[model samples]
Target: MSKQNNYSYIGIAFIILVFGIIFVPRIIDRITKGDITRQESRSDYAEEKKAVDSKLSDLAFIESFGEKRKVPDFSFTNQHGKTITNKDFEGRVYVVEFFFTTCPTICPRMNVNLVKIQNEFKDFENFGVASFTINPDYDTPEVLKAYADNYGITNPNWHLMTGDKEAIYNLANKGFYIYAGENKDAEGGFEHSGNFALIDKNGFIRSRIEDGNPIVYYRGITSEDEQVNDEGEREQISILKEDIKKLLNE
Candidate 1:
């Protein structure tokens, strides 16, 4: 071929290279829908995923703050003269209250409410009820047993406990976060909380219900000068019944 023909071929090659550099990408983008801006469009699934992620974050935050508070370990004598301890309640859920058998006021109401709970949950093998007497000096195992009989409570899962005064008081005030102390000015010469505690299988104090409302732990006691009305007692027991079921299912 002549030199002029070779130059003509080189010019054609240069024109083709320039066009490919500028227009080839546009052509590919048109054919393949490869524009990055178009890929940023949102869909319902993406919105849903975002919402689910937000909910998960919120749940994580709640768990960080609401981790379970564990009940302290304890041992005491039950109504049947059996030695009961924290180990007996391991892997089980139970309700606990502080009371004496002979109290002329809240103790009777507390026992009646507890019997209601005992009857409601007696079928659940993992459920139990415990009443720790603040006046252990007078409430012996035999006395507790007699009190249990007076209530017609024969369920072995229900325990009326009596033990050292200080140990029982410590378990009430510190472990269960309830109040139990000697108050000469109070009814029956002793003061204790009317609120019932729901303990989980792992021994954590999961919930406390009083007066038909869920109250803060350790704050359900009637003051030495105050008395819990019958209406308040009934409401608390009703709330406690539902809370017990909730913890059991959990």
Candidate 2:
């Protein structure tokens, strides 16, 4: 062989030798340490994937200042005439709303949507609803019971609650930050926020994060069939249902 050809062969061998010394060991070390992505076991891969998915899929906490907000303690009478308190919802995922049995406008729509939610998660024992009546004087346990029957609210955990009017208002306005009051000028002689607040198993209020902020409440006035209302607000009941499932799993 020519000396020039021999030189070229040496150069090629030197490059190969350098690569073996510098990079091959790193590749082997990564595999040995389980740092190589493709070398991961199926179960390990699944666990890592689950963790990442959990971070992405988990709902946001409704926070006040830097502290996470939670559903405040409350005591009210349910349709069964049993006293219901915040303790009753421990270790359960629930939705909260304010309504009156006599409402002629938005209350029916709200309850209908709530019934749909109730039916969707009927099989899950840990899922529930807390419907607080804004007009407690008119919505006694008997009246609330009849209203629940009329609406087909069959979820055993679904509670139609009524108690002191001022306390109910305080819970709605100051506690949950949801609006509820006697509005003589409004339809049905009362007004309330047409939004539902989601509470997790631990009583911490939860919601979907959007644009780096917690939406805090789902629009109860919109049906799943109505994707967006005349006011251009998109219906959130579907997302709410999915979130309830997520919380239930958590």
Model 1, span 1-250: residue lDDT tens = 9999999999999999999999999898886674544554445568878875653211011112466467678889998789999888887878788888879877776676667677888789989877899999999999998888899786677778888888999898877668889999998999887777777776766655336544643223333223445355324455556666766765
TM-score of 2: 0.78
Candidate 2 local lDDT, 108-194, one digit each (tens): 999999999998888999999999999999999999999999999999899999999999999999999999999899989998889
Model 1 — which ten-residue stretch has the worst lDDT?
55-64
Clashes of 2: 0
Clashing pairs in 1: none
Off by over 4 Å in 2: 1-57
**TM-score of each prediction:** 0.65, 0.78
Candidate of highest TM-score: 2
| Per-model C-alpha RMSD | 9.3, 10.4
Best-matching candidate per lDDT: 2
